[model samples]
Target: MSTQNVAERAVIREARPEDDAAIGELLVEAFITQYAKKLPEVVYTDERKRELRDVAARRKVATILVAEVDGEVVGTVALFPPGAPGSEAWLPNSADLRGLATAVRFHGTGLAKPLLDAAEDLARKWGVDAICLHVRKGAEGVGRLYMKRGFVREPVGDMDLPSVFLTAYVKPLK
Candidate 1:
């Protein structure tokens, strides 16, 4: 599908190796706003930044899609293959969706919906039975979007991050 059709000003396409840097930049910018002083500095350091960029470049079992406007990336979403290693163990039966970010400038533009639509479409194509994602507390807007998109919240429990209350959102693919 043509990216222009989704959003008049943005184009959605599969992320390429060259997009690693741009995607990493977007991640840092987007996360910093939500995480602010709470997130560790190392998470945004050059080395760890490169690691994220590399992950986007490798693609691995995770499919990363980007949204660009006037040749600049403004949003991104990633869907990992079911059963992929390091996948969210809490939702072992579901495909893991990650790195859903949109440039702050693009906020209220509905750019995120198309990115998510692409992820869900890709997940269905991969024969995934369900989709799962983690949203930190205080990110009510993000959670509400997923809820509106048909995702239901599962119980919170053991996880890597604390008080962050790993809220698992799931949506059946089939």
Candidate 2:
């Protein structure tokens, strides 16, 4: 299929309760596949699994968008105020797009870009002046994707982990 066809086949919309299990599984599978080679396998363990699963089921509390193809969910993301992504850090009036993941089969299928674009739009509708996100400090590749999408690196907040640090970025929507 042509690249445009693949992108066009994907539909971006709000997630539903019935999608919890699929969303959870996709998050774990996609995240591990992308980061396992670069980071230690131990970090992607049971606790992490449970966390992703629980977070998926709770997406209703905020704006969670899912990408679907031919009726199957292929990716997901959410927009919330700061500190909603299990972090205590706060960025007032900014909606932080978090919990993003794409199914392995759908990687590079343009699913994530539109999901992000939708999240930014949601942020604007919610009256937030900016949209924000966080990435592992050493994850320059992941950070580059956000940078290319208009997010600017922010010097505030740090999520210090044993294996890596987390840094924040923001894209002005006002």
Candidate 3:
């Protein structure tokens, strides 16, 4: 099916507690399994996998949004307002996004854009001036997707972590 067709059938909403496990599984599947070749093995450490699966902990500081297709969670993205625990935003008054994941089966189904759109909408609602995120440095396709969605590379916000180097992107809301 085409991206538009699948996207039309998808529902985007804030995740409920019941959806936590599925979101974790989806994250691992999309990040570690599906895009394995796009990142280094070191990036997929046991700690990182646990972090990906820790939906409840992450939810404490950010709003977790899920994309549902046929009543199943297929994608998720976390939006963190300024000063939230997970936000690595360097820009003042910016919201940060993390853990943007789409199930392997939904790849090329355009579910990502809706998920991102929802995050941006939420950020706007929170009165933030911009939304920012960091993508793994080597994930070219993911970076392209963000760029195509109007997120500009903000190299000054980039960071180097023990697991992977991150490249920053930001989308201005006003």
Instruction: State each model's CA lDDT, in order.
Output: 0.75, 0.77, 0.87
Candidate 2 TM-score over all chains jointly: 0.88
TM of each candidate vs. truth: 0.81, 0.88, 0.94
Q: How many clashing residue pairs, candidate 2?
A: 0
* Model 2 ranges with Cα > 4 A deviation: 1-4, 40-42, 82-89, 161-164
lDDT of 1 by residue, 26-95 (tens): 8877877756644443245576556566655448767889998878888998887778766773554578
- Sort order, TM-score high to low: 3, 2, 1
Clashes of 1: 0
Model 2 pairs whose backbones collide: none
lDDT of 2 by residue, 1-174 (tens): 234555578789998888888888898998888887655543677887897887554674566789888788888987775545443324777776778898887677777888888888787777878887788766788888899999888877556767667888878887
RMSD of 3: 1.8
Q: What is the lDDT of candidate 2?
A: 0.77
| Residue 90 in model 3: lDDT | 89
State which candidate has the highest TM-score: 3
Candidate 3 ranges beyond 4 A from true positions: 1-4, 40-43
